[model samples]
Target: MAVLQVEKVSKWYGKHCALNEVSLEVPEKGIFGLLGPNGAGKTSLIRIINQITGPDSGRIFFRGEPLKPEHVNHIGYLPEERGLYRKMKVGEQCLYLARLKGLSSADAKARLKEWFERFEIGSWWDKKVEELSKGMAQKVQFITTVLHQPGFIILDEPFSGFDPINTNLIRKEIIRLKDEGASIMLSTHNMASVEEICSHIALINQSKVMLDGEIKEVRSRFKESIFELSFKGQMLSFTNALGTQFELLQHSSDADLRLARVKIKQGLTVNDLLQRAIPHVQIESVSEYIPSMNDIFIKVVEQPEEQMV
Candidate 1:
């Protein structure tokens, strides 16, 4: 079942339209990526989802029920722009925020302790927020955001301030949360992370959803019939064998081994290409090349709006 569903939701700010009939579904117990370039209305949609503002048109549903005010308590949000009370101690701030999420003081404290230790930042608990580095503060904010054990979590640019180690740490935590039955919506420009973590994604551009689907399905939908071949043989023999059956897009040689990327001709399959090349080259490996999320994002965003769908 979908954890969240948006139906033709639109939002406008005076003369400017921030979201134009946007619609997408975030499935239950998995990570959903909300992707778009800056100024593409990602933040606007997020705001509407969080109830920071109402949509000018259309409707949203949470688990089949119309979204309402009480739903806020079941949703946790960590925005792109980090906010914290610099004067407040890290533990103090976490406790306050946790309570606001409806946790008892004692429960909040216990959860905070567990989170701090898990993040290896227990030593910073008594320190003021101002004393912590940007990354450290980010970790604290993340703990509080999920402290109340909300069923759904919205994280925008969650990896913004972390180093590679911390980034991986957060990535693992996100996966763990999903395994524990929490639906997560992740918004970030980091396509590599999205490819690694997102089960599904929606790409928005010019205030509209250009594409949305399961990651593998989307990649297959845009695949260009390209394949990579690794073989030990003369490059000339391989190219000559390919002839009209394939278009050699790229080729390289290292010692006795050679590699080539070729696009199979229409009506020709991988087996066809293999049969044709096997006689000329000693085939080591053959794998189809799938476009990365980064490539798909660029291609979709650059296409004309009318062609995006």
Candidate 2:
């Protein structure tokens, strides 16, 4: 089921078209990745969904109803640009944001304590926001953003400033949040994270939705029928075995084991590739090479204007 849907939304900045008749859906549960390169109008669409700005055309629905100002309380957003007050104490600032999100003062304090402890930032509670390092400030913002436990969450570049350990900690928390019944929208350039956590995604390019669907399905849709193999074989014999049935895209040798990628000929299955290789090479293992999200992102967004959506 969909938690949020944007229908034919369009936003124009003066004469600049940021978003052009774009539509997207956020699932009822699990992470939905909002993917696109810079200047693709992802942020514009996000703002419209959050009601930070109104679209010049189309509509947005949340839980099957028209999105309204009150719905903002049920949604939590962490913007790419951090917005904590520099002079406020970490704990105080979090409480203020929580109150703004409609949390009671007592409840905000309790949740803030729990989050600070979990994030191992309890000692920084009294530090001024300006005194904290960038990553530290990021941590405080991250905690406050989700402290109210909203059902719908939008996180933009949620991992941008953290070290590797903290990044993993946040990643784990995001997965946990989804498992605990919260749906999330992850907007960023992190293709690897999208692959790891996003169950669904909508790829916008040149101000249009070029692709949209479950992650696995999207990857499969762009498959080029390539396969990777690992084996100990003579390069010459391997080439000869392939004959005209396969096209070698890449090959490399590591000691005795040879790694290569080939495009399967039409009407040929993976079994065919293995069948032809067994006679001439030791076929240790083989697997289909599905293109990564990064590959698809670059491929779609960089194409000629006539090719992109």
Candidate 3:
């Protein structure tokens, strides 16, 4: 089931197009990655989804119905920019935001107490927002965003100011939320995060969506049919064995072993490469070289505009 759909969406700032004919469907109960470099119109599209602004030409749907004003109540948005009140006490601010989301006073307090305890920040409830460090403040804001139990959540750069431990904490919480049936749209430049949590992704570049699909499918689509092999043997013998079926992309020496990155031609498999080289070398490890999301991001974004066309 799709929780959100954008059809032929386009946005413009004066005569300059910010998003052009972009369309994507986000599945229910899954994390969808909205990725791109700076000035790629990702924020424009996100703003349209949040109804902060209207699209120049397009339509959006939520839960199979036309997106309406009331849908905003069902969304919990954490924009890249933090918006906490500097002078407001932590507990007070959380209760206020919860009330704004339609929670009763008593219910808001109960939920805030639980979240504060779970996040291990209960002792800081009375502290002013300004008294907290950036990561600490981020935790408070994150708790407030999810306090109302919104059906759809949008997190923009959710891990921006955290150390590794806190980053992992947020990651675990995100997974837990998805497991509990909340759909999320995660917008970030962190490709590793996308790889770790996203079920599917839509890659937008220069106002256009260049790619969209399941993570594994997208990686396979861009695979170069390469493999990395580690072995202990004469490099010349191994290279000589691989005459035409494979091309050696790189060769390097680790302390006592030879490492070779080889690309096989189409229709050739790892078995073929192994068969040819195993006779001459003692193979320690043989693994396919699938490009990481970071590598794919650079390759796609750096492509010429005409090629993307």
Q: On a 0 to 100 scale, what is the lDDT of residue 293 in model 1? A: 96
Ranked by TM-score, top first: 2, 1, 3
Candidate 3 weakest lDDT stretch, 10 residues: 300-309
Q: Give stretches of model 1 more than 4 Å off.
A: none
RMSD of 1: 1.5
Against the reference, the lDDT scores of all candidates come to 0.93, 0.91, 0.93
Candidate 1 to truth, TM: 0.95
Q: Which residue runs does candidate 3 get wrong by more than 4 Å?
A: none
Candidate 2 residues lying further than 4 Å off, grouped into runs, are 305-309
Q: For residues 215-268, what per-residue lDDT tens digits would candidate 2 score against the true structure? A: 999999889889999998798898898888899999999999999999998898
Q: What are the clashing pairs of model 2?
A: none
Q: Which stretch of 10 consecutive residues in model 1 shows the poorest summed lDDT?
A: 300-309
- Writing each residue's lDDT as its tens digit, candidate 1 over 74-109 gives 999999987899999988899999888888999999
